[model samples]
Target: MRYMSHLLPLSRVARLVGQPRSTIQRMIHDGELDTFDGMVDMNELLRVFPDVRWEDDGEFRRVEEIKEKAFARRVYERALPGKEVLAERLHELGREFAAAKSLLLHYDRVHRFLDDKLDDLAERAGVDAVATLRHWLRTELEAAPDEAARAEALLAQESVMRIMSATVTVRPSGHEFFVEGNDTILEAALRAGIPLNYGCSNGNCGECRARLLSGQVSKSHPHDYVLKESEKADGVILMCSYTAVSDVVVEAGVAGAEDIPVQRVQTRVKAVERLNEHMVALRLTTPRSRRLRFLAGQHVTASIGGDAGEYHVASCPCDDRQLTLHVRRDNRPFARRVFEDLRKEDTVDIEGPGGRFVFSLESRRSPVFIAWEDGFAPIKSLIEHAMSLEISEAMHLYWIAAAVDAGGADHYRDNLCRSWADAYDNFFYTPLSADDGLATLVERVLAAHANLSRVDLYVAAPRPLLDAIREAALARGLALRGWHGEVIEPFPGAPATG
Candidate 1:
């Protein structure tokens, strides 16, 4: 392999070093592995694989580097006679003292070595070769101290060090700045004097979401809450999970992390059959290790091939390990590729394991209020999660939906409805088209359940209903906070406004 010097694929090198393939590719783009073009194979990668692992993908190396640089900056600050400069920091941070460093030897082993040589050659040797210049220098003068110093200074001055850098765009808040760059977007933002909004810098908190109007960014952490492919093309990104891959522009308003939950890839579409003219009951499957972790009634954004706005996850956050999503297709909204044409084995991109609608038996209230409409997707998850925790207290549920068709493979609803009817306080059903049945969403739940905010009130339905029920509960002076509702499209931006 060493003798061949070429032909090694990057995936193989990634395996040898125990890293993700994406990491290896990022390092190459960051100029860390600038030795090759795009692909790194047997001979080419083997050359640099020994000393460095995955440069972009390395968690430990990045942190340590940040620490070392911080130390260097501190030393630079103390050593400065007056104003601090980056050069002063570099000089103070030298690990070894004055060891006659050779410029040729220093640049030879780096990925940028060849590129530097070519660029410098273009400027100095476009018409004359270095050999001819050296011959002239030897004949013209002997080794002069001033000339040698001048030559070394020029060479040193022309060297490029920083590889992945970021810029910033200040948001309307004026206090917070949106970060964009190729490698470390947030890091670069901090360097540029921007107060980047962050809570739990890890990808778990969906606080760092921002729109990238231009340029590219890479994830600083591995993430399951990936934006839809269409959203990516449209420039929406999760700042926490992304490291700018190139120069980028964005809206930098940090959505409060506590308000959002990170979506994890837990299951696949196991069963899909129609429940009504506009609804489909989807049973999703998942492995034990990748089980979902979320509260009941919380929902997720589900998309195929990254087209966001496909649909929302109707699953219990508590039972997320092996999750479920009951999709009531607005035939109009998901009429295209993601929902209608999506099939088994197709990858689904999800975001938001969100919504505050949860029923905790621990509360003084025994019965949790559940308003189910259109379908069983969202409501079933909440009920199941509540029962899993043995909240034996009655679940006073008002199942509100239109069963427009009985022949459209609506068999799944029978088992789901029967399973919970015997287990809780009361199961109320209402038909959408019927005059007496569908009109009283908030009114019905209020009639049967207590009005105190202490009672967990859950509403999962169309956006119109969600807003109506939410407003009614709050207007009654019953602190209807901790309200959890499931909507179809992701509420754009990190702001709590939407």
Candidate 2:
């Protein structure tokens, strides 16, 4: 029997089947699953995963828990769509349900008319064949479809997904993310680690405007930036003020390192965490209206009490409202202040997210990140961003720490790296001791990679070590474009390591 075709976005399909988006994309690449215009058909999903019980899927339980307990009020509120958006989404779903029901009613009438015609023919001509035909039609109509229960479960799951979130696809970049909770398009995009161009996220700058290609959206927030009538007719909307009501496609530019303008934000000191005697993790929180916008692996200049220092941001861009920087103990004024005087709630001015050593957005190659001592800060940011992007390729991280007695850094966040390795099947972490010298350490790193041609290498170390890794990697057929290196110089009066 033919089944109605219901298409789901790739992200939604991944969520429904309890798989990572990368895993689903890999299946598509390997021809294990088929899609139509990048969307998976409900029938196709069922056929590909015949053993899956949709009714018993974890997503159903999650939705149920959300409804029953209002689980984690803060998280629940953040994950739910606003009332206006919820109403529109429900209205849209209702329209679809009504259409399907109307079609079923129409089909029922047709079946009755055909039955009457068959009865008339049988009576008029005493035709046994017409009687048999009518009986066969009635039998087929009355019998349950083989996939009835599973289809019903799938539909129920899909309805819940639609009500909870809507997928948004950016045209030129082809980045996709779900708009969940009360988040506007811009908020969702930032949270997903897709660096779409925007300024003043509260909707004053009009930098977040995009042309809608399809699907429905509701104005979730008021914007002072007015769209010209012609632009409105062309379906332009401010991403900061609109909430997606259905899966939507919009044309927008994805920002690169050069495209982002430098802005100084006054941030409050959230915490001063001492990772070790030599290093401290400075955590800062920006105001809700003015979050620092920077790609992962970039550096920002932070100032407190008239003392400033340039440090690489150690936090992922997906981490909203928070910025983390690793500061090593040194004679530098900024470092001294952090260790001696910086306190929670103290204001620190952040400026210039300067550096080209950001993640390569288009590289599908496996990423190999090598960090030397304190250089791990930027590498940490890159890894988290890659995680947020959900890259399908396996990732390898090598951190070379110095012995404490030698005045070198230790793996301060070693547990966090281990947790990531434990959480992701595709992630691998390796810690090496720099006591063996850079030559031997580099050799070990190179030896582990049998095929360098298919991997992107990102190294953060002193200039000498950075060059050594880059030269060795390139000699092994690693593409020049695939190499990203940052020279991490030691602070004044600090021992030279790495």
Query: Considering every candidate listed, which one attains the maximal lDDT?
Result: 2
Per-residue CA lDDT of model 2 for 161-260, tens digit only, reads: 8999999999988889999998999999999999999988887889999999999998889999988999999999999999899989999988889988
lDDT for model 2 comes to 0.90
Which pairs of residues have clashing backbones in candidate 2?
79-181, 80-181
The TM-score of predicted model 2 comes to: 0.94
Which ranges of candidate 1 are over 4 A from the true structure?
Answer: 1-267, 287-289, 310-312, 317-320, 331-341, 360-362, 368-372, 403-415, 424-434, 437-442, 450-454, 467-477, 481-498
- CA RMSD per model (angstroms): 23.3, 2.4
* Residue lDDT tens for model 1, 391-452: 42345555553334521213236556666675433343332221233345467666565555
Candidate lDDT (C-alpha), each: 0.47, 0.90
* TM-scores for candidates 1 onward, in order: 0.39, 0.94
